[model samples]
Every structure is written in C-alpha cells, then in structure tokens.
Target: MTPAEHPQPNAPADPASPAVELTPAAAELIRVLSAVHGPLMFHQSGGCCDGSAPMCYPRGEFRTGGSDVLLASLAVEGLDEPVPFWISASQYALWRHTRLIVDVVEGRGSGFSLEAPEGVRFLIRSRLVRQPAS
Candidate 1:
C-alpha cells in the first residue's frame, strides 16, 4: 500500500486515507458476509433511524448512478478485494467534511442489509475532518 493511502508508522499526516473506513469487527463481519453473499457494497442514506445506517448489499443488487457518490473502497483483512462504500449525493454534500467509520454492533439489522440474519448491524460513526489551510 502506498504510504499516503495506507499510512505506516512515522508517515506524514498529509494525504491521509479515504474519507471512510471500517472497524476491525466490521471488517471481520464483512469477510463472513462476503463469503455468503459474494461481492458486497455499502450505501448510506440521508434519512433517520435504520435509514441512516449504512446498508450492505450484494454488488449489482442495488443500482447506483450519478446520484450516488462512491466514498471509498474499504479493505478488509483476508478478503480478496475491497468493499465499495457509497453515499447518497445529497448526504455526501452534508457530510463531505467528515470521516465516516463503519462499525458492527449487536442489534437487529435492517431487513434490507445482508447482516440482518447474523444478528449484528453496521453503523456509521463520523468525526469532523480538519481541512488543510491553503
């Protein structure tokens, strides 16, 4: 991995990783989910409650177009490939300056998300990103 894309010890702080990432638990769970569901993608909506939660779907099952923004392709350890994370364009407009983290928690997941049957759900947590002074 490039030092800028995947930071190593003592690496420069500038040119950090993507705007979104996955927690270890979330990444492990993704390894399980992807094994059963094949390739996967994540989409977060601008709505409330579960609607606001990031929903993981089998790739191609959910149609994405210009209205959706591809935030990042998150890497999960032991997985053959990265998972694409997407957000509604309008939601991106509101959250563009924040770093989004996907975490897995014990709960009833949305029926639409593949993780629902596993008794765990994916949640989005955010931290404000400081813009570099020009």
Candidate 2:
C-alpha cells in the first residue's frame, strides 16, 4: 500500500487484561510525540529480564514484513527519513504472555518509553531499552 494508505492494527480479535501501565509523565510525553513526530514505531531487541521491548519513532518509511502489523501511522514534518528499528525475540515472548503490546506515543525527558503493567515506567534511553536496528 502507499505510505499515505498505511493500515492501522485492527483492534485485536480477543480482548484481555492490560499488561502495561501508563504514568502521568508517560501520558503527557506521548501526547507531545504524537503532536510532533506523528506516528511511532515499536521494536525490540536482545537483553535482560524482559529480554527487550518496544520503542517509537516519527513515521516515515520502513522496510518490513508483509504480515507486520501497522499499529498506527503519523506524518511529522522535518523528519523525512525512515528510522530503522528491531526488537528481540525474547521480548516478543514477554509481550505475547501479556495483553500489553509495546507501542509508540509521545514521551517525556526521553524521546520514547516502555510502559510496563500497573504504572511502572521506563525511559527509552535506559539499558533496558535496545536497538537491534543499530
């Protein structure tokens, strides 16, 4: 599909308990990111405990799989290039166990975030965050 015609992730077929939480700080940040960057990208990579998790970026272009779900899309000015990203298989396993899916939205202090279940918060720049894309 054309970039402008990008499709959003269809609401899941099954509803489950929320596995992630959002702090007031996180909520405000996502609002800004959404207003500025537009759409965010979610990705994960290898690491500890949770193994790795999701992140967001301003929407542009991405080289991805046909089955890859497009959760949402945004158009931000100035950032005209696609930012590359990846998430670890281990992290994906964690996400699968919970109803929570890593997502991209505006953020505070950091450019992105990892909102865990029950208001637990983590910044995008933490060691807990990974960039397999790098």
Top of the candidates by TM-score: 1
Q: What TM-score does each of the candidates earn?
A: 0.84, 0.39
**Model 1: which ten-residue window has the lowest total lDDT?**
1-10
- Candidate 2: deviation at residue 98, Å? 3.6
Best by lDDT: 1
Query: What lDDT score is found at residue 64 in candidate 2?
Result: 47
Candidate 1 residue runs with Cα over 4 Å from true position: 1-14, 131-134
lDDT of 1 by residue, 1-134 (tens): 22133224222233465688888899989999999989899988898889999999999898888788777888878888888888887887677667888999999965599999899999999887754334
How many residue pairs collide in each prediction?
0, 13
Model 1 residue 87 lDDT score: 85
- Global lDDT scores for all candidate models: 0.80, 0.38
- lDDT, candidate 2, equals 0.38
- The sequence of per-residue lDDT tens digits that candidate 2 reaches over residues 1-134 is 22223322322223333223334554455555555656555544445433343454444433445433332232223344322343343443333333343333332322244333224433333212222321
